[model samples]
Target chain A: MTAADHAGWEVVIGLEVHAQLATTSKIFSGASTAYGAEPNTQACLVDLGYPGVLPVLNREVVQMATLFGLAVNASVARRSVFARKNYFYPDLPKGYQISQLELPIVEHGEMLISDADGNDKRIGITRAHLEEDAGKSIHEGLDDSSGIDLNRAGTPLLEIVSEPDLRSAKEAVAYLRKIHTIVRYLGISDGNMQEGSFRCDANVSVRPRGQQELGTRAEIKNLNSFRFIEKAINYEVERQIDLLQDGGTVVQETRLYDSDKDQTRSMRSKEEANDYRYFPDPDLLPVEISDEYVEAARATLPELPEAKLQRFVAEHGLKKDDAVILTASRALADYFEAVAGAVDATAQVAANWVIGDLSAVLNRDGKDIGDSNISPAALAGLVNRIHDNTISGKIAKQIFEAMWDGEGSADEIIEAKGLKQITDSSAIEAVIDKVIADYPEQVAEYRAGKDKLIGFFVGKVMQETKGQANPGQVNQILKAKL
Target chain B: MSLDKVKVQHIAMLARLKLADEEYASSVEKLSRIVDFVDQLSQADTSDVRPMAHPLDAAQRLRPDAVTETVERDRYQQNAAAVSDGLYLVPKVIE
Candidate 1:
């Protein structure tokens, strides 16, 4: 949609994200929560909703939720109830989904998202509640009937709801991204959108500038990617504005974003709107978290992304952008810390190698930092070489590539390939004398006040040494010779 | 307060139950009595008390996060009306 389309209207957006908690077992059952198993094999009697089977909540789920609550600076509920949301579908083996209604586990949370102006904007979180995921329904394969796989039916999820604080699609993306980073950093969830482990639905509406009341909202459902979230919200905003301009009122409904079409179409209208008669589940009692439990969970939290980013900036003097990229994942952050700590005097140099060359190699192979062929210590060895002038930065790149190819450590590669920088003054002077003799005209030019000719001499000596001479020593010696 | 015909119909629709026109009279009376009884229960003043979610005051017992259940798909799928490749088959539902 064009900016002119929403010129006079203010877009209001809130997100509802469903993150599957990474646990060994399902939330209420002993069924394994591992993905990609044979259909219905991991589903047990409790997950299949067999009659008279009771649900016993997992202790680790609460601990993880407490960790998340503390990470977001939120209050952990002392008592939270599990309510049953009544619905009927083949995918829902149980007639209703077990969820939280009036009392959620975490509430009044907020996170800071970098606004478009590059300022920290605090987005208010309404609540994050615990819920159970439904099963998968396959429709195409069977002739007359659909197939139901209850494997994912009882998996635990945290449904995080945000306030209507976002003003633009960019801000929505930023807010969603912050949530994704927080959940992954907390180690509570894998936050894999492609695997449907982390998914979101957007509630979007628009109003004329200066109008207090909000326009009728049409919810865009099941947006799994950041780009789609922005695109779907923008499309929905333009649609509502166009409808309003045409003297037609917007209808409140649930819409699906067709990525193929890049548009959100209504899934269900208000007439078919959901009426989930939520009541406390009688099978399970209330979950009460004690102060001691919260303290223990707090102890388990490592430095969060924001804290680590600030530490990188304040302690290591890294650029904010570089720090952000380095701390995007826990493994990457740890990798950077080790590399930087090894080369204590020059962390920016360490940052450059990790964020630049090592990242390029990892990206080229489509591998994560945890899966990089070059270990952090080996990369640190390479970085230290460049700092100590054992190998010039130019030669270090060559050694880096060799190390990525499993050619051994940086020092080993230097020895095997003979790519060490020539730092000995005697050896450098010999190359400089040869350059001065070979280019007496240029030396005479240097004497005649063409200072630019120094570059020419430096290029030659570097070429003579096959680009292995210490550049600083080359410059110092070449000036003395002329 | 009594549940009227329209309210009863909406409740039935939400429950996915289709009621005939003749069945609405008795259904409204039965459902109205249920609502009225709940309304009577609401007359007690519990404003100072905490909202009770369960009848028992005991906290929910937690099990350790360990996979203790094994796959018994063949045994469970025996009661299915139809089965295909170890999947329970029902009327085609798409949304």
Candidate 2:
């Protein structure tokens, strides 16, 4: 069958992002929230559901939730309710998790995502509320007994829901990236994927664009990487399209993305709302957020990534692509700004070096800019050396390579290696004279009006000086002798 | 909402549960009650109200472009029932 008409088929994508709140202890208990702790040692009586235990809402968790709401420009509910979600698993010693059901702390908001073309798309935020996490189930060896890890139990999780506003896998990834940036900028979560600090569950559905009837949607769970998010959604969309083309109806259910196979497989029949038997949690009291609290959180929010990206373009004279690359992460953006401020001689040059050479090295080495041996000041020092002609561009590249190897400062490396550019016309002229005397055939070729011999002469001079001679001086000396 | 015996058996198998006949009879009755209570939720006039997927209204968090961990394959596979050449082994049903 021909691909579903764009005018007819519409892809509705909603994301449920789970961010582990940056807290030292569990949400309702004093259990350590540290990752990679010995399996059950982190568990406490409260986390293990001992009788007579009560869940005291962590104040820091509330503040973190409020910070996220303020960052998203969402409304903070004056009062919210926590409810128990009932389910059975070996990892869930409590038999139920304390989650917000009826009333959530944060309400509706919108996130503006800019596409590659600089067009802004607004993704709708439904709610962001706090909940305690369930422990993990490790199904490793025994067929009859699965290992249980309670380290994650009672961990504070802020589950953010989005409206089905994303239309493509790329948009879904962009939305995830924007959310990731905002949360990290707000300092609410560490957002580490490998540690399961931040995870995504995507709800994907394909429907006729103008059709009132909605197609069944599949929820793809536990995708942590942006690449996987895009690939999983794209694959799911194709699978749904193929099923419909083969005269099959899409089934609504939860599925797991097999990253190795690059496919989504049905996990189980999707649970409806009533399955959980959700009711107001009696052990906890209703959370009351004051106007002052919301206002304070709003005031404490730092400038968001999108705002910083815009400022980078408007104020720093950076290209949109360069701005996007620099502001992709707060660390990278801060590093760029530090270097840019140091070398105000040219902002574009600074951006180019960071986004081009620096990014290339980091990507090639599989290291983040923060992990590079070249610090912001050191990078700025190298750029300044180039600008002041203390080193040629080629020499600067060589120095940068050494700097990345954890060698001492740019100046030290230049001095130790004797890589400083020789800009003196006399020095260049002497080398050029030796080259003209040695290559008489090239000299005659130049005298016979073969202008290309000039290039040969310049190359000879640069070779004689071990790439330390200035290209401009060599060009001037060669042209003068010819 | 009635949990037929076949449906009960199917759910149990899907869950990888091996149940006795006596347990199956009791579970069917108990599960029917639970399902009936859940079916009542369908009666709510949620036509206008949007179904909420999560309680919170926040976005995803991103990590720095750095490697934070390394999974030592041999050590990780130590817990597996069977492993070979950096791979986990499972019973082959295809053959």
Q: Which numbered prediction scores highest in lDDT against the true structure? A: 1
Q: Can you write out model 1's per-residue Cα lDDT over A71-99, one digit (the tens) per residue?
A: 88899999999999997888888899999
TM-score list, all predictions: 0.96, 0.83
RMSD of 2: 7.7
The alpha-carbon interface RMSD of model 1 comes to 0.9
DockQ, candidate no. 1: 0.85
Q: What stretches of model 1 exceed 4 Å from their correct place?
A: A268-270, A436-449
lDDT of 2 by residue, A1-482 (tens): 34543446788899999999988877887667878765666666677676788777777888888888878878888778788897665667677888998789888978998665769888999999899988876555545445655667889999999998888898999888888888888888999998889999999999867877668999999998989999999889888888886789998888899999999998865354236767877777777777987888788888888789889999998998889888878899999999999984588899999998899899999998779779888899999999988888887888888998888999999999988889988888888889888999879988999997787877778889988888887887688777
**Residue lDDT tens for model 2, B4-87:** 888888777545589998888888999999999999999989989855433554222222222222224345445557544333
- Clashing residue pairs found in predicted model 2: A127-B56, A127-B57, A128-B56, A128-B57, A129-B56, A180-B60
Interface RMSD of every candidate?
0.9, 12.5
CAPRI verdict (incorrect, acceptable, medium, high) for model 1: high
